[model samples]
Target: MALRHFFLILLVVSIWAFNNIAIKWGLLDLPPLMLTTLRFVVVALILVPFTRVNLHQLRYLAVLAFTFGFMHFSLMFISLNNTDAGTAAVIVQLGTPIAMLLAMVILKEKLRLVQLLGIAISLSGVVVLSGSPTIPNWWVLVLMLLSAFGWAISNMIVKKSPPISPLTMTGWLSFLAIPIVGCASWLTESDQITLLVNASWRGWFAILFSAIGSSIVAYSLWYSLLKHYNVNLIMPYSLLTPVLAVIMGVLVLGDSMNGFKVTGSLLVILGTAIAVINLRNLRMHAKLARFRYAGRSKGH
Candidate 1:
């Protein structure tokens, strides 16, 4: 990669990793479901007007939004509410391998063994991160793993489905998320508005960054990169999430990191680096498919 592209990857990955910290902190003040719902609503409102989509687009948006937006995140926040923040950060990285597996089955993409190893390595980090001298409940482990798969499946859906404008995809999916999560929130969470009103400005800032910066700006940039670059090259850098999460936790959240976190984080980072990176050719092949799809549409 060129020096500039390297930094672009760095910048985007930073945003994503930091978003985990943001979500964790936001949860301090808001219910997980309500906060997620609010974030997507903001993203949806901001992006919806920029692109024009017909009814056909609306249907596609609904599916994507439900799976990626509502279903995936609903599970995630529920899991987050139950698990430790540092541990949750590591667990979601499990999405890397899950995406690779799903991509092979659904998208018919080949997965290199190196990538498989990366997944295992990163996953070991989860094991290390989750259990202490005291083992956490197995239920928590299962829920966190489910959350990881949620994100991975969502990534696959985005990769496999017919291409749309990134903004259109982002906007509609987010907008659609509001009703499902909102109803869930309304039914389960009494005093929703009170929580919104009483939240500290810091919480509000976290919410805004997560809703707008991470979901809209960061995800938009990510989709653009995926549209233009090789995902394998990009996916490894996702390992950075746990790293950044630790930094943010210690620095901003005043969370402590123990020796296990250090060792596991190292293993995860090393595993991801070994498994997935240096895939310029892979990117070319993937985008060629996108180009072909675009061409077929024009001919029709």
Candidate 2:
């Protein structure tokens, strides 16, 4: 990847890291489902005007809607409502391993020994973090994991789909999700009118931030990167999300930061780096070994 693209990836990671805080901020006045509904509504209204969708790929788009729109955002916002932003962010990195597994099964992709080790290490870190005493509830982590799974599955679907502009798909996806999430909000939550009417600037700011910054800008850039690079290469950058989230969560939300959580976060980052990096070098090592063997055979 070019240096500029790497920096852009970092920018996207930063946006997503803060997005957890935005979700939490919005949830103060809006119900989780309602917050999600408003978010997609904003996303659709802003970007849908510029996007053109193909009716032929409605099935793929629908699948993306379910995975990203209904499953990922709904569970994620709800999880953020219930959990610490940093913890939710860290737990969501489980999606990396989940995506790797899905790719192995669906795409017949192979993992290096280092990659497998990294997955194991990162997963262990998650387990350690969740088991720590600071977490308010175990079920919240489970919800976050489900959200991660949804995200992973959605990524695979995007990879398999025919080339479509990321912004176009995102806009159409927001349009599709509005009704499903809106209905869910109405069915599950009360005081929607009361809260939305009474929501303050902070709440409204959170909504706008999530809709425009995270959904529209960050996700569009993310999908564009996915189109250009291998998923494994792109996915590892997500490890940074948790680190940034932890910092923001501590500063903004006053989330507890202890030694155990710190250690766990480090383990996750280290493991992810192990799993995703040095693939080119690994292949080069294999080639060098083969060359040495060929030279020896000729000498014999």
What local distance difference test score does each model get?
Answer: 0.74, 0.85
Q: Over the stretch 141-234, how does candidate 2's per-residue lDDT look in tens digits?
A: 7888899899899989989887778787888888898888899988999989899999988689888999999978898899888888766567
TM-score for candidate 2, residues paired by index: 0.86
Best by TM-score: 2
Cα lDDT of model 1 by residue, 1-300, tens digit = 447767777788788777777777778888888888888878877888787777866777777777777667776776666655566676666666677778888888887877778768877876776654222577767777777787787787776567787778877888888898889888888777999899987568767988777777776767667766666656666667777876776787676667776777677667656656646666676688689889989999
Q: What TM-score would each prediction reach against the true structure?
A: 0.81, 0.86
For model 1, how many clashes? 0
How does residue 218 of candidate 2 score in lDDT?
Answer: 92
Consecutive 10-residue window with the lowest summed lDDT within model 2: 277-286
